[model samples]
Target: MAGMLNIGVSGLNAAQAQLNTTSHNITNAGTVGYHRQTVGQAARPPLFTGAGFFGQGTDVTSVTRSYNQFLENQVLQADNRRAQYGAYSAQIGQINNLLADSTTGLSPALANFFAGVQEVASNPTSVAARQSLISNGQALASRFQSLNTRLEEVRQGVEGGIVQTVESINTYAKAIAEMNQRIVVAQAGGAGAPANDLLDQRDQLLAELNKLVQITVVDETDSGKANGAVSVFIGSGQPLVLRGTVSQFQVIPSAADPQRGAISLTAPGGNTIEIAESLLSGGELGGLLEFRLVSLDAAQNELGLIALGITETFNAQHKLGVDLEGVLGKDFFKPIAPTVVPAVAGVSTSITDVSEVRAKDYRVLVSGGSVRLFAGDEELASLALAPAPAWPATLTGGGIAVSLPGAASIPADGLLIQPTRNAARNIAVGISDPREIAAGGPVSVTSPLTNQGTGKVANIDIRDIAGMDGSGDGVPDFSAFALGFDGTGPALTVPAGFTIERLKMDAATGEWVTDGSYPSGGSSTTYTPSADSSGVQFRVTGPGGYTFDFRFSGTPESGDAFSFGPSVAGVADNRNAVALGALQTTKVLGADASGRPTATFQSLYAQTVTTVGNKTREVQVNEAAQESLLDQATSARDSVSGVNLDEEAANLVRYQLAYQASARVMTVAQRLFDELISIGR
Candidate 1:
């Protein structure tokens, strides 16, 4: 009977314990970093029978947490990926907003300024319009200056975030290492288990670490400890946070520039770890850095490009035009300096006030139709004449040069008089009527040469010389291009195209196939306009220069033309030449106003305004989409692991009921034992 009672008591105790375990699991179900627990039971012992023994009672063996190591690892990995993109995307979205702001953006100011320029161009003599244009230009400059300052501020913010992240990672690593030490100690002491709570704490830390950087964990054994230690490292067993007595990882700032505040991890052997952000794939810090540096850098470069294109184009136009009467020697647009600048033309060095400097010091040169820029005394006409389809034929300068339609006398009355050093500066040559120029024959233009004695004959030529018909396949021909000569030199011989030597005649081919180099007496020949047919002749210019004479063996074909490129050493300026002819004096405002610069200026301004508006729209749409996606992903992740107060409350009540029942069972057992003892006495 006593044994039977003992068996019933054991069963009650085991049942009560199981109920407590279940309650605990339910209570912490809503808690972060909690695992479900279960109570395991087994038969205490078997009575020895002749053949076999039967179980007498049940005993609680162990309470194991219901956990899957592989599943937990999967969750951690996924968290790292999500965190990286989450942080980076959030930050970038903010920057996009800042840049896309209409009031603060540079687009509006630029549009306003260009519109003012159009107004001025429409009425060149209007001082009001000119002053307005200047004001608008100043506003545009201010916009660029402010935007650059803001970008620097954003860069500083990113650096601050990087430093904070590194510090956080170190803190977590130390906590994890401490937990490992405690676990080892407990296991060695023959404790029930290596403190499940402590293990959970360590796991929580690792989850946080994944957001900052990627990591891998391995089970390791300590020679003196009962339970093997856990070793933690980055990606490939590069021990970072060691699981000895204490955990430590090295974090250092970039050596190149401390101000940049970039951080990196180091190994015990003092080897620096190179972390490729893109390869990291799922680390918050890496993602943030990549977005801040790479993505932002690209955006800044693109902004600079647009700014550069506009600056170069506008400055080219400004270089050609005449400013206010007193500002003859000044450049309207400034040239930007080379430095860490936000936009093109942002750090330009232009003389805003010519009065601060002397006119002669300005030494400005406007482009003339006949003038060609040369690096040295060498002729580049042949290469210069070659067609470049991508090159815009319109002059960069906004100014348009206008000559009288016919060879008529230009009225001297009320002529704008200004002294300029620019080679392309407008000059009223000999007095001629604007309406008397004829279509045929050369018209005598009498513009006063800057230095007639110095051979500076600035004139406009509109002929085949301006077009790239010689070499380039269909480039627009400008008539105002010009070339300079020393007068004592050999007449120029411009080649249609350059020639490169290919294969030479081989020994097997006795015929003159491309093979052997020029023999001791071997000669090279070039073609020129023939006296007879347009066909070319390979003529030897010098005596004894020709080892043999040659000719085009095949008969003539339609559309075939004789072309020449290389020249004999004796032919001066033939080595390479630049054909300078006419300068196309088209206005920047519009194509219809081919010679009217004022109209062209208006057209350019309109294009800039349109482009800015379009960019604004694109940025807004992209940002909105990014926000929506982030919200949906967050909601889905939360449903799986989010803490809930109601669930915890329900678990608390259930555990209280089990505790009450266990106490009642113990009370009843005590009463029964007291009664039995009384009867025996």
Candidate 2:
């Protein structure tokens, strides 16, 4: 009878534990990260008897939550990727819209400005036309400044977002560390039993942290048993949490670019290590870093490139012309110079060739007595400081020339060179007066009607107007200079105040080679022509120090000649304005692999727009795909670990029935014990 009663009581206890677990699951069914718990049971040891061993009641061994490590990890990875793409898509869309909008974009402004130039070219003497040109130029500059301002705002927003994300990650790290401590204590007290609820909480915190930054989690164990603590690492194994201790994330200015922010990990020992942006491959923080590097910086630099092109090329051509006042043209737009960070003393950088400039920032590193120039990670040029780095030295690359003064020393930290990064922001119209516009060429070429030869002069390039001014006067010294090509050779006739250089085209390379030069009043007046020389090129310098280049094309009969002289003052000579207007179609932005000019100002801006639009579309598609994957992964994980209300209800009924049956057995045992006592009486 005693044995029967002990078995019944043990069965009742097991059923009650099952009912309790099922009720717990039913109550917490809506809880996030909650895994359904179950009571683990095993039959107690059987009693030994003469005939056979009798089965004993079940013993409740342990209660465990349903969980799958692999499924949960899948969900985490998918979620992290989705978050990264979503963030990227959001940020890049802004740039796409800003650059692609016709009204707000650089395209309309560029077209309008060029149209104004054409109008001025058509009526070179009209003050209204010139004033309109100035107004349009100012408007164009304003548009550039506006675009740059907006991009800067976006950059600042990204920096702020990064800072906020790091703070949130730190917060999650601290909470996870606290949960780890609690879980370890709880599990220890439970004597090897897992702290199921505390583990869920820690995982929830981890999921939140993963949204901010990509992370890797490792199970912390003691003697091959899980202690319910995890080690969390980010950005190439930098620890965020380690065995109940939390590390911190910090936002710091980048060493190379102070304008940007960088991530750092503060270990428990108080040592902080900077994390490379490339190492972070997923999550919102990763998205921000990537957007800044790949999209934002490139967009800004390209915009600045256009601004620089306008400033440099326009100013150069403008200086070659004569204004309404009959003086040489000055800079049409304010000059832009390269920006160097941690300014090296006596070192200055300038854009020497606008056509060769690329939209990239450079770094100058001084190591082992040598200065190396890098565009991103690619080393472009290196100069050894063998002669103590001579002053007035130049290191030229990427279309820019860096001028270093004598005795200049580069900082140990190096220099960050941004050639066009701030050009748009700093670009402005240089001249305010309409009369200051240079719309006339300083020198003119004329072919007399009497010449019978098919030869004609074309493509006059003004080298230096100041070079033609041989006298001490500001005005160019006009002269009667004539070049006649006879069947034997070419002869030059000038009034002793000119220098002439003769050049012939190379047959193989098609480049002109200088044959000879005649200084002022040189006795040599004739040159023999090569049989294969199709055309001849000459550079003429006048007495007032003005220089110009002209090309003679086609076959010339003997006595055929072209005359050179200064342009008439206060005349409607639209030659320079025509040249300036031609800049609208000039290919001056960058070069291709074949060394061909790749884009004009308008096309370059269009390319920028297209690139940003494509990136935005790609990120959107990726975000959608990752979202679907996240959903699938979550469903798979939830199917194994999530609670079911109907299942718990069914379990409730089954455990209730088992409990009633166990009670009935106990009642039967009690009655049998009473009957035995009755028989003894």
Candidate 3:
């Protein structure tokens, strides 16, 4: 009877414990990260009987919380990737909006500016038309400045976000460290119960941290640590948390860019090592760094390319003509100068002219012997590193004059120099005067009085205009042609460096006629030609850089002579404007460092717009995928660990009934003992 009573008591105690656990689960059902608790039960040692061992009532063993390591880790990864793409999509959307807008976009401004060019070309002597063209040019420059300024604003916002994210990450790291300390304490002193609640909270904090930066975790329990602590590392195995200790990081400006962000972690020895941006991935921090390093930088330089190309091409053509005042046309637009960015700290750079700057970014690598240049991964040139008398010594290549200190050593990855990053910032009009417009070509072509033949020369126009080489040699190299036709052809003295090419025109597309003209259809008659007799195209090649083209269509007499000379000062010729307007459709943007044409300006800009739009859409799709993954992970975790109120309620009723039944058995045993005592009296 005593044994029976003891058995019932044991069962009652087990049932009471299970009931308490059920109540706890029910009350915390809405709590995040709360795992359902279960009271484990096992039958006590069987009582020895004559027949055989019989089972004793059950006793509670241990309370365990359900968990799955794999599911939780998956959730963390999903959150990380979702954050990265979300940030990237949000940031890149601004570029798409700016470039695709009809009003503020570059396309309309480019078209309007060219329209003004055509108007001036149609009426070169009209002051009103010239002034309108200058206004349009100014407007175009203003648009460039606005777009560049807005992009800088986005970069600044990214920097600010970095600061905030770093702080948040540090805060979470400290909280996690604190939780680890409590967990170590709760797990101390032999066969101790796990601090399941503390672990849950720590996991929650870890998920939050993953959103800011990707991290890898090492649970010491799996690695033979006594305290079962967790260690967290980020970005190429830099430890943020080691056991209970937390390390802080900082964001600093890069040597190559003052406003650029470089993440650095303070080591245990108090030294700081910079983390390469690429090594860090899978969160908002990764997204911001990637966008700034690649897309944003590229967009800004490309925008500058437009500014630099227009300024350089227009100014070069403008200088080749005479204005209404009969003076040589000076710069109608301010030139963009080269910019040198130092890869090493304390080094500097500069440029000489806009024409010297290309649209491509140059990577300057230093060696023991000399400095090397690279466009992306391709090496373009190298210059012997020399000592500087002037602060930044000049090394010219890749269409740029890069000024670097002769004494500075290049960093391992090299200096990234972008001469056009700020090209659009100060793109304002340099010429405001209507009379300053260069409407006439600098050279005149006319027939000499001595020509007795029926031979006639077509009107000559300048192509391939080069800036005055500061050699006082922009003068026309043409004199009266000693014209005549022997049985062979007409001959004249051709100077060196003078070029001849056929013209190619597309009237339907309105592209300017190219200088690649065809060979003359008619063969030379009784004349000695300077060029091939079969090819009636004769060109006076000059030793100077002066070049212009014309064609002859008639038979030349032996004594026929012609003269091509410098502008007879003050001719109201709109010939230069006509050629200048042809620049409206010129392919000037996509050029190699050697000045080879690739794509037109319109195509390049369109490509950029398409890239940003595509990137935005890609991020959106990726974010959605990541989000779906997160949902799946969360569901898997919840299936095993989440609290269920209905199950808990059922457990409550079952445990209540078990406690009552055990109490009733003890009462019955007491009643039997009382009856025996009464009968004995």
TM-score of 1: 0.54
In angstroms, give how far residue 306 of model 3 lies from its true place: 1.6
* Cα lDDT of model 2 by residue, 576-639, tens digit: 8998998898887786554456678988998899999999999999999999999999899879
Put down candidate 1 lDDT per residue, 609-643, tens digits, no spaces.
44434443443454455445545554444444333
Model 2: how far residue 656 lies from native, Å: 2.0
* Clash count for each candidate, listed in order shown: 55, 14, 18
Cα-lDDT of candidate 3? 0.74
| Span of 10 residues, lowest total lDDT, candidate 1 | 574-583
**What is model 1's C-alpha RMSD?**
19.1
Candidates in order have lDDT scores of 0.43, 0.84, 0.74
User: lDDT score, residue 253, model 2?
Assistant: 86
lDDT of 3 by residue, 377-474 (tens): 66766776454256556566655655565545556656777777888896677888988888887666677677766566655656544433334454
Which candidate should be chosen as best, given TM-score against the real structure?
2
Residue 203 local lDDT, model 2: 88
Q: Which stretches of candidate 3 lie over 4 Å from their true place?
A: 221-226, 342-360, 384-396, 403-405, 409-416, 449-456, 459-487, 490-544, 592-595, 669-681
